[model samples]
Target: MPPPGQDPRWETMGLVHDYLAAEFPLINKTLSLAKVNTYGLIYEWTGTNSSLKPYILAAHQDVVPVNPETVSTWTHPPYSGFFDGESIWGRGASDDKASLTAIMLTLETLIQKDWTPERTIVLAFGFDEEASGIYGAKYLGKALEETYGRDAFAFIVDEGGGFKDVYETIFATPGVAEKGHADIKLEVTSPGGHSSVPPVHTTIGYLASLITEFEKNPYPVELARDTVPYDNLVCMAAHSRDIPRSLKRAIFRSGHSNAALHRFEKDFVLQDKFYSSLVGTTQAVDIISGGVKSNALPESAFAIINHRINTLSFVNETAARDTQTITSLAESLGLTLKAFGEDVIPESFYATSHCSSQSSSTSSSKGHIELSLAFNHELEPAPRTPTSGKESKPWDFLSGTIKATYYSHRAQGIKTETTATDGDNVDFDPRNVDGNTDTKYYWNLTRHIFRYNHKNAAYGSEIATGVHTVNENIPLDHYLEIIRFFTTLNNECR
Candidate 1:
């Protein structure tokens, strides 16, 4: 993967493409393939019936680059593709390559069995997802929209949350929505001078104060009804075995009572930082830089605060909150404030106020502070995927498929059925992705978007398995189960 704004190096990706072509000859000959931006792969298997809408299985071909300093800490080489009779160890083993490989193998198997479908199946593989899919899915999305028009597909499945044991029950979590994203860049400028003659506060000092103010006030957490997190909690309360009785009752009542909802949020959600972050817009000052010399005062200082906006909020709202956060401090420091190119505190107003004050006699204003979007990428929260009622047939079908996959993989001699009805083997729930994925670009192609991979989260320690970190690996049985899930989905789709 490349850095945030840099172009990806495609030498290794080209090799992977060649390897796929050589490995899946039947799929290559049967399906139509197109390369978008010379790297993004799109494969389409046209169905016999043109009346039914096609569905897409999306995956990324790239993985986060491994750190060279951590190479020695790995049990196996990051790129080895070594299978120690249990798991496959490599960089992209679990994050994405697993899904891509599963889709291909599923298609190849179906082709070998001479199975023809009434509904078409499309596979979209982007190469730069680790860097926000700028050069990959962005073009693939356009090509897909041009070919099929908007809302052409029945649904889209991308790599995301999978099945995990929660409260002693196996729950399959398919991401029904994703949070919004923004990076706010805060910059402060002041007069440079000798350290001995420095003013009461320097540029760095003012920036620190602004950052402190931001931390002092955070977005409030609310358990709004109909949200993904709320729905997930309801499912947990309804299906999980070991939830506290009182908490379960509160979760049930939360659907109608605002008092009960806030109580649940206070007692449960707010108690955990992880849960609170998912419910509210989160902020983190990831990057900061200031002085170049110690002998002289710093002329300018800046910091980039990353935000994952809640599903209920928008980019403008977040920016407004940030502007309000530091306005008072900026005014007290006699600094002009310009937020997102709009002047909040004008130089003349501060100068006039300073002159009018009895204690302050200076007519000239102090330096200014500017707030702007760090990157041009500002995404609104994704449209929620319907998970119930008549319009949610696609979601029901997916949930049934997940249950069937889970049962058949574990129990022998059990026939796998893919009906959109309740079953006894496993439970399903809608969840939200805290971060964005390649699905961000394909939103217009399908209203029913599911971010899920059918891997069991209980296979190993999540941090130990190391997605985007050291010792990344996937169990061989888990890989086979993913292929099984895809095969069943393709077979069951009408």
Candidate 2:
């Protein structure tokens, strides 16, 4: 990846537009290509049917920056588009460029075939999805809403969930919803002093104690069948060939025995990292800062705690509750706390002891703390995409196409368990995207938003494509499957 300052959004898109203009003139003639927010690209392909709603397929143009110090550790240069007959190695190979390439090629093929759908199709490539996506998807979503009425699309697909062979079952998870997100700022203040004399606790120390409290008390553990994780588990248990009979029974009897289902999920199912994140809100103390001088005692300290709100929460409500929880804890410790940069603390902080904020919290410290809490960069989780019966056309088309493309490997006597990345049986697994995507900004534009790409693999597991990590690569076979999936989607959706 290029340096953050040097790389400009839409540079790649400009090249792509030029290439398409020269090689595929028909595309320019048939589809309207325009840039939104000066960088985000939207290519619209008008269809014959004015009555049918549009569809959108999206991918991001950016990849995470690679550290200069770690460049030498790479077997091949991070930006080198190296193909060793089996896979393509590069920073964005699997993260998003794969989808961008696959989508472009699929659209080109459709143009060559002169096939037009009855419904309109949109290809949206966001510029800053790796960052906050504020200028990219945010502006694009608003523009789309203004141009087309609210809930204008039949379905919108973006990158999030993917296919994986978990527990011997080839599960194709389509991210039906995403976790909300917020970065809460925790700042502690104190009177400064020389190194010679220090108070009983400094700002850092108080922050540390607050952090400890947060660690001691995690969010309450309660998994309902409605949550994406449990729902996905139930789907897997039903579809997989050899799940244990007891587990199958527990899932089947979930209506009668909710306790048994919850126990089974907590004790057995959530052992996987991917499944664990889906169950509840998560918090990580990502950034912290304190004194600049080594000789002087620090007077002030600050920290940013990033929170991923579970499907159960709205971002603002979650942040408010966490802030109040911290205030209560601070009061218990004989310290005063203010929130959102206010001078006077809320009266409710003293009168109420409610803890409806069932969201995860984190903190850090150097000494005794008094501080103000503030939240920024917040977004509530997306509306859940429908996957059941009548309104499941998008789900059916996507899952059915995936099955048709990948299940043939199984029919050819290929064992899915041969390797982690080899599975492609494509069972429908509707799960929440633990991380936010560009689709998060488009929630108002469409009720049917699915965060999915057929070849996406859960990271940290053996099958991962190394997204945002060192030595990122995409297998040629998996890349082909992506093209096939999109091609199938274009043909079948009509």
- Measured by TM-score, the strongest candidate is 1
Model 1 lDDT, full chain set: 0.88
Q: What residue pairs clash in candidate 1, if any at all?
A: none
lDDT of 2: 0.73
Q: Given candidate 1, what's the lDDT at residue 447?
A: 87
Query: Which residue ranges in model 1 land beyond 4 Å of their true spot?
Result: 1-8, 357-362, 413-424, 459-463
- The per-residue C-alpha lDDT of model 1 at residue 151 equals 98
Count clashes in each candidate, considering only residues at least 3 apart in sequence or on different chains. 0, 14
TM-score of each: 0.94, 0.86
Q: What is the C-alpha lDDT of each candidate?
A: 0.88, 0.73
